[model samples]
Target: MGFCGGCAKALLIVFNFIFWLSGAAILGVGIWMIVDKNIGSYFEVLNLDTHDQFFKYAAYILIGLGVFVFLVGFCGCCGAIRGSKFLLGLYIFFLVLIFAGELCAGVLMIVYRVQIEDKIDDALESSIKKEYGESVTITDAWDVVQVQLDCCGGNGPNDYVDSKFVNKQSEQMIPLSCCVLTNKGTAEENPKDAIAKNGTACYDKLGEYYEKGCKDGLLDWGKEHTTILIGVGIGIACLEIFGIVFAICLCRQVDREDKY
Candidate 1:
């Protein structure tokens, strides 16, 4: 290979290795999203049978894209090392497809961002009012959210005033998840192991329950982490762009050598 070709090959190999690592990271994230009690519970409360499965759908997409990227990175690295035009071309095609998919996903996120927020708010409130204590999945979801976010109900402990969960109890009461825990971090870590600071029901002990609402708490959490997410996204985009350019340059160099 010529100097330019050799440089491109080396860069391509390095970029593809990074891409492969990223793919694995994405896959791990996807799996985490699926299994994580905290985040996964949020969508489970939406009840896929009746409500939008937005988060669940996103996790599945991530998994599929991650696998695709992993294989494409392998192809690109092999193609660059072997100086094979065919593999390089195939790698480029997959990159283009991934870029398009990302563009579409970004557009969809922009368009539905507000709508999703509103829907999630409504769905969560509805679940607390009607599904809590009735549906095991939704009950668990709310418990997890309340414990993890250090918040209560859709808005606050008051949100359960006329809720089915409260009405069903022998007397006015709120979920233990809404109470101040005896074990500070354990309940947040595992709701099933949650222990309230006192035996008193959260409904009667206004001072003991979390004043913050889950909705506001969730918004605050998102704000705190948004910057990290954005930075990672931009970094990935840059890497992909560089990978495409290097692949194309190397392809041309291979063609030039073959023509001679």
Candidate 2:
């Protein structure tokens, strides 16, 4: 029996409502995660209940809509099994509308979250140099250490003093980074801050050091997004495959004219 597209229209409409709402809700959550990151809710899983709302009151509506869509789609597919042209056509459309939106949003998120090291490095350098002096040295791990000549005094708060360090082993390393600011010398403050009130070159130089750590963290996030996108893609592909198989089987079956 030939499948008619008209019977499928209602199912397709419902499917869109389900998928669009689910996607929209998930998008809202993702947006929250990007900006605030403190909202604690996890209703956007990928199962039948994946579309449920976590903390959002409005999510209840979406969840209900999604449930209704899935049920209707399920019933339509069952009817399609007996070659009800209306049923077969509607179920096929339902699968396409529902899953397509979900897959696209997931893919886009993975792409947009990628991090570029150069951009991160530039920001680090700009912020760091604006704070420290030109002579600050950057450790390989991105630690910024301001170098001072043997304790030097100036008219103001930022006088650099020579720093001497004896490690737990009584080892001596006279790192210029040990420079001290004379105002209120507490061990909590880094000696670098006490350096001469110089230009941003110091912060910029120091920032290079900081960038290493920040960039590493950012790259890790980029990699994670990539992996998630890949996983989502694979899952959607699988679902589409199943949906297509069901659609094809329904199309070739004998026609059932009964309304029930």
Candidate 3:
């Protein structure tokens, strides 16, 4: 290999190193999602009969992809540095597989875009019917969601009236997390004042806290972040293309050098 080939090899090493690090980060995120109680609860709530295993298997798939990418990146780096044609060929094969998988995934997401919203709504409705207070996990998930999204219920506070938890309680009420507190005081500090000033009444004169439903809030959030997600996806795809090209070039250069 000549000067240009050496430079290409060096660039490949740097790119593969970065790719390996990214894979490591993805693996860490997958592990965190799987182990975090809040995430587990959130997945449990979202899981539906139609898509019972989607969330559960998503984390596992992420971990698998992370491991695959990490191994491929490592092989690319080693192949480039050691001028190994066999390892370079292996790296190219994996890159093509990954690229094809991503392309299919992107196509599927586009085709099923409308169904995604319907599925989310159905899952949310199904989740709300269960006993929220009985399970600490479910309760915690709901509280965090309400607080973070600043919203109530699947559709509205009314959705809670039919909930097993709300029906079990003597007084008709929503979770304190739904309330928009005065002066941002803690719900424990002033339960009465925690209720929003303009909030309407639910059944039995219980304050109708947050008017906005999580469904809209979550959908809006997704809409806002879609551009960023697309950009990241494109960037990753470009990186994969570049890796494949460099691997092929290096492999050819190594072959030519062996003939000389």
Give the number of the best model, judged by TM-score: 1
What candidate 1 gets wrong by more than 4 Å, as runs, is 45-58, 222-231
Screening candidate 3 with a backbone cut-off below 3 angstroms (N, C-alpha, C), the clashing residue pairs are: none
Q: Alpha-carbon error at 247 in model 2, in Å? A: 2.3
Ordering by TM-score:
1, 3, 2
In order, what is each prediction's RMSD in angstroms?
Answer: 2.7, 15.1, 4.5
Please say which candidate is ahead in lDDT: 1 or 2: 1
Each candidate structure's count of clashing pairs: 0, 10, 0
Predicted structure with the largest lDDT when compared to the true one: 1
lDDT of 2: 0.39
Compute the lDDT for candidate 3. Answer: 0.70
What is the TM-score of candidate 3?
A: 0.77
Using TM-score as the measure, name the better of candidate 1 and candidate 2: 1
In model 2, state the lDDT of residue 99.
Answer: 64
Q: Which stretches of candidate 3 lie over 4 Å from their true place?
A: 41-45, 48-54, 108-113, 130-137, 181-208, 221-231
lDDT of 2 at 243: 52
lDDT tens digits by residue: candidate 2, 1-260: 33543334333344434444444444554455434311111111001122234434444533454465456556554654344666767666766765675577566645544433335445444323332233223221122212211211111112212211122212322222333324323312444344423224222233111111233443454466557646745664465556555555545443333432
After best superposition, candidate 1 residue 59: deviation in angstroms?
A: 3.3
lDDT of 1 by residue, 163-223 (tens): 8988898565688888888886877777889888764746575567787788876656544
Q: 25-47 in candidate 3: lDDT tens per residue?
A: 55775687667654454455554
